[model samples]
Target chain A: MDMKRILVYGELEKERLHPVSLELLSKAKEIFPESDVQFGMVLLGSGIDGAVAEAQKSGVDLVYLLDDQRLSVFHPEYFAAALIQAVKAFNPDLLLMGATYGGEELAPALGIRLKTGVAAHCTDLRLTKEGKLAQLVPAFGGKVIGEIFTPNTRPQIASIKPGMFLASPQEDKNASLSILDASLLDSVSQRIRVKGVNRKELSSLPVEKAEVVVCGGYGIGSPENWNSLEQLAGKLGGAVACTRPAIDAGWVGDESSMIGTSGKSIRPKVYIGVGISGATHHICGMKDAGLIVSINSDPNAECFNVSDFKVTGDGNLIVRSLLEALG
Target chain B: MNIIVCVKPVPDPDKYNLLTIDPETKRLVREGIPTVINPSDKNALEEALRLKDLYGAKVSVISMTPLFSVDKIKQCLAMGADEGFVISDRAFGGADTFSTSYTLMKAIEEIGTPDLILAGNESADGATSHVPVQLAEWMSLPHITNVTVTEAFETKLHVRKKTEEGSVDYEIDLPAVLAVERNSNQPRMVTAKGMVAARSKSIRVFAKDDLDVDESLIGLCGSPTQPGELIVPNLKRASQELKGEPEEIAAQIITLIKKSGVAVAV
Candidate 1:
């Protein structure tokens, strides 16, 4: 049997392994045929001992670690250089990472250096009958899902979103851990200087961690109509969320409060969608919500299909009525 | 300064509902949908044009699309791009972000060394946000994505990039690529005079052989990722239409909400 190599870029957040990285390991184990593949993980950062140990516990075959101070903060130039050097050294058959801000910046850069193709923000991944990797991505404004393949590229690359897969079971496996030499550190040309960073304090009830969420979409009509939804959310003790359209229309503040492929993925206990047309992108963000209740004027609105209890009525009028009835 | 803005013509996002996936080909059926410059790319072009207006600079727009998208390219020209290039060819069909950026890299090399390159953070259709960084890597240039503020100096650029947490400011040397986020700047509409000038302003078209590129690396053959079986998502819902007047319907909605365990004090 021919052995294939799979390398997952394990992400670390504040010296801990990101849950999404474990999710990738879980997915890598399930999708790639176990008998014919070696699963490994690559970790890069300063003070990565904890993450490295955590990676070993995941039961992957090998763990490659590059510890350096320069990697403490993410510099695309440094990160890309290190990743490219590792790829050249390992020559894995597949590369996987989360479709995160860091991954989004790094994956394409890596693909460019390797002269290979990369599929980004993938929702699903599968191995074809011919044993090629297939990446399912949302395209055409999230109206259709495109199943993409990289037939000719070596180390087929894909960056996936979170909540797409679950973490695998932890079992005792003799895993080899090796730290790479710092030779590539000299090649990094830090061109961009980070002057400063200004981070916003997430709202008390940030949508990503909220228990209950009230979401509004384009069908909400105007910014003025947002009040009705907010009122409903206030009464229901839920945080307010909106789709991309609402954010683009300035009804919602910034991209953080938006729920969709480009925004945040939320799995609240209850997600109430008001006037949402249910684009595929919007659904991906909130699909994992415990129970979905869609209220749209159009009965045929796409949001209803995924809804547990859908009310067909005008969004603005219905929300106001719901609020008044509660009062 | 020489600034090149990468623009993509995407299916009008407003008509996304009309889109369908070719179950056999597993590709978007974008035949009749109207095409427009992606929303953020317009912001990118607007930022480029603003730079051109402030300091003397030439803004050139490049897009990889079919020949049918010439009008969309001209729209950028009308918005004040000095020149436009469309790397359109049958061979370039079904090129993913990597192939698309490789093609753009070749076109950029042929266009000459630019002081700066700008593009939308992500395409409205693909939304990969990969082209800028990929192009930068192909050329070995430093790049940043999700830039909300930009200031150009003689040899470097001052930019504010948006992160998941907040924003970070940076100063990148010359010949770097930056992907602009939405609201970077409001894109200008085409004026009649601008339209007339666009008619005379030449738009260059690059075919496969126009630049030094390996045939194996130019199109589908060069593309590493290919599509597998496409699954059409089942988005059907059990819809319940609330009957009667607004008050009566509101009462029923309240009942459902209360039953769901979200208490209503009333």
Candidate 2:
């Protein structure tokens, strides 16, 4: 039996191997245990020697380094050409990437080039009994899990969502690294240039870092009533957070303020959700909070199921009452 | 200027429902759900149309899906795409992003390189936002993601790329790839004439052999990633009760805050 080789795309950043790369390696190990699972990584950009050293520590058999001044910034065309050339040279059975902004765009484009089934936002992966790739992805806005398989294809490709799998633990510092020169076609007119890269600062007082979090939902109504949540958060020596609806209503910024799938994922010590109906998207963001407290009007709200403490009442009235009681 | 907008048909996010994995079959029970164009891709189409209207460029829509997606191609034509192409094959099933990009790159090569290749920032189904970037890589063309604004110049293009904190402006040469943000522009409606023209337009379909692509490098055989398992996180809520009149309730809230030892300045 021929050994299945797996390739994980993306550069290994200094001090951190891209999470999805580790996840792919982890899944690859599980799927092709008996097969010769040679993990390959593609690193682009200058000053990636540190990254190359880190990739060596991640248990990859070979690292394809495409170090060029033109590859410093993520120019799609150039990177894709390099990747295609690399894949053709070192053919692998599967290609996995992180479902980040860059990964989403890169994955489908690769799918088109390869004329293969490219499953995006895959949350789960496994090998079928018939020895084919089985990818489980969310079918409808995370409402359904669709199991997709490629029985008759050679290299199955997928992009894994962040936080879907655990990044592999640091291995022994002595893993061997083989560096291969990834020949990239040079370009004359690179379309997009990164004039400047600005990183968004996470909230100064992130709810995730807070020992206590006081969150509000749409039931609080009007931005004016937000004062109550602030007061509660202030009293608790914590920060305030809001559901996606509240954030979308322009009541809060993306940082420290919003807690949901699209926003920050938090696990505070004490999380109090006010008037939150406990949608899955919202709950997944903070379900791991140490002590959960929910105050809502609906008796059968899903929030009750996960809360350590439950209060059935209108959010506004209860918040004000709590404020008065605190005083 | 000629443009090719790559669009994909995905299952409607709103209509998605969880299926009970028959522990035995472990397959989704998708019996009665409708699919639609990915929301972001719709925005991409709208942006394409806007560019055409602004500069009178010819726009072609391209996609790769199962044979069932022919209706989606027709819809794209109705929406004002000058032409359409579908790359569908049984062998192409269950490919990852790498293979998908390879297939799309082949189509782009066949369609003849255009001045601009427009795509949505992300698909609702995948929402990874990597396809356009990958397409750019395959074509060896400059590309921009999270595009909010696009202005075509005589010999170059100017665009604003949306970042997490703010937007940055860039001026790139022609023949670039751009992934537009979903909220960048409202897609225009299909005109009556466009509907008629679309009906007359032919959709070009290609198989694995149509493009000079290695079958091993095009599909599952060439993909590197696979989804392992999917467990939908369940949502649970708790309830609280505050018994009192309006003013009394407000006062009670204050008391509760005080009792919790949280500060509340009245």
Candidate 3:
């Protein structure tokens, strides 16, 4: 039997294996026929015992670990070098990483080093009959989905958003650990250096993980109207998200709160939009919600075409009334 | 000091709805949609200009476009760049990020390397966020993406890069590439005098023969990734309209919210 091996590059958040790694592993196990293809993980870091254990719990057949003090902080050159070493150790057919900020930095560097194409911010992945990975990517201002393939490359590579796939805990399976060489870091260019880091702890659930999201659009008119929407979100026990205009207007300070083509794609249980005209970019981010309701004064707003519930009225007035009614 | 800033002309974000995809071609129908300098790239140019102001750095703006968008880089000159170059050639058409990055690398090589190179972290259209690192790898330079702040002194540079949560500060070597993020600074407006000066400053246009490049490593041939299939997203929904008095509509929304089994504090 021909053996095809897939590798997931484990990323960490505050010293723990990020959920996206397991998410990618779960999705890979579901898609790849287990009898034909085996799964492995390549994890690189410094003093990451916890992350290694979490990666082992995912039931991958092998785990390639490169642990050293040089990797405690993320240096793009060192990180890519360590991953290259791990890749050599695993010799996998495909590499997948979460499209988080760190993943974004590392993926392209490795792809370029390996001389393979890297898909950016893919929403979905599947294996073609030819056994190539087919990446579903958004394009054209998020109006179309492009099925992309790296036809001539070994170890097809792709980066996906953290929340794009659901991660289910797997029954623990013993994974053999293969430690990579740490000496590879000596010759690689280490021009990038981390001077200081300031990581702010999130105060609440991010919009991507929020079950209910209330998105305020450009037509919200003023910051006062945004207040109504925020209160409405608070009453609903949901998180607040906004479009670029809201962020540009200084109504929203947190960059993570914005949802659109350039920002996070959310799949909330319920999405309530206020004064959103349903621009193609904004709709692309939230069209997959379980329930979508748009409140706009313009009855002919394009967003209504895709909304599960369209409430045509003055947006701020309706939100205020909703706030009061919920109270 | 010499610096190179990369720029791109993308379809105006405000007119995205008018843009469509050709069913037969499976490509964006950009006939009537006007093009504008990518928004974040302006931030990149502004940062370069700031460096020029502080250290007498010479800023050269570069881009690869299919059309003779001389005015695109001309606008960059109007924004206080020292020089501008537009690499437009029919041979460079249909290139993806790989070829595009290689082409830009050739242009950079032709002009000569600068102390620093800057580009927007992500393009408004492709949104790949790939070029900065790919070029860094090709040229063997260090790079930082999503850079919110940049400061350069003798022999070294200081950068503040934005993470998902907060920011991390880095001190890299003199010769480095940085991807400037959006909202880093407000791009200065083009003054009438600057525009007048730009008209006389003819942009250096490079065609296929100008730069030393491998024909196989450029244009469509150099691109490793290919779009296999294209499909318009399914956005149709049978929507239920709620039109009535404000309170009544709000009550109906509550009822629907309750029925959906989503938790509601009120």
Best by DockQ: 3
lDDT of 3 by residue, B1-266 (tens): 99999999888877777777788877778788888899889999999999888888989999998564667788999989988888889898877777788899998999999999999888877788889888887888999999999989888899998887688899999788999998999999999999888777767888989999999878876787887887778798877898899998988888878777886656
RMSD of each: 3.0, 6.3, 1.9
Q: Which candidate model has the greater lDDT, 2 or 3?
A: 3
Q: Per-residue lDDT tens digits of candidate 1, residues B1-266? A: 99999999988877777777776766557678888989999999999999999998999999999998899999999989999999988888877777788889999999997999999999887798999998888888999998999988888999998876677788899889999997778899999999988888889999988988877776776777776555556655555555777778778766766676765677
What does DockQ come to for candidate 2? 0.27
lDDT per residue, candidate 1, A156-181, as tens digits? 78898766776768567867887777
Query: Which stretch of 10 consecutive residues in model 1 chain B shows the poorest summed lDDT?
Result: B229-238
In terms of docking quality, model 1 is: medium
Worst 10 residues of 3 chain A by lDDT: A1-10
Q: Lowest-lDDT window of 10 residues in candidate 1 chain A?
A: A1-10
List per-prediction Cα lDDT, in the order shown: 0.82, 0.70, 0.85
TM-score of predicted structure 1: 0.90
**Model 3 off-target regions past 4 Å?**
A1-3, A129-131, A169-171
Misplaced by over 4 Å in model 2 are A1-139, A144-189, A197-202, A207-220, A226-244, A252-262, A274-280, A294-313, A322-327, B17-24, B67-71, B89-91, B164-168, B189-214, B217-266
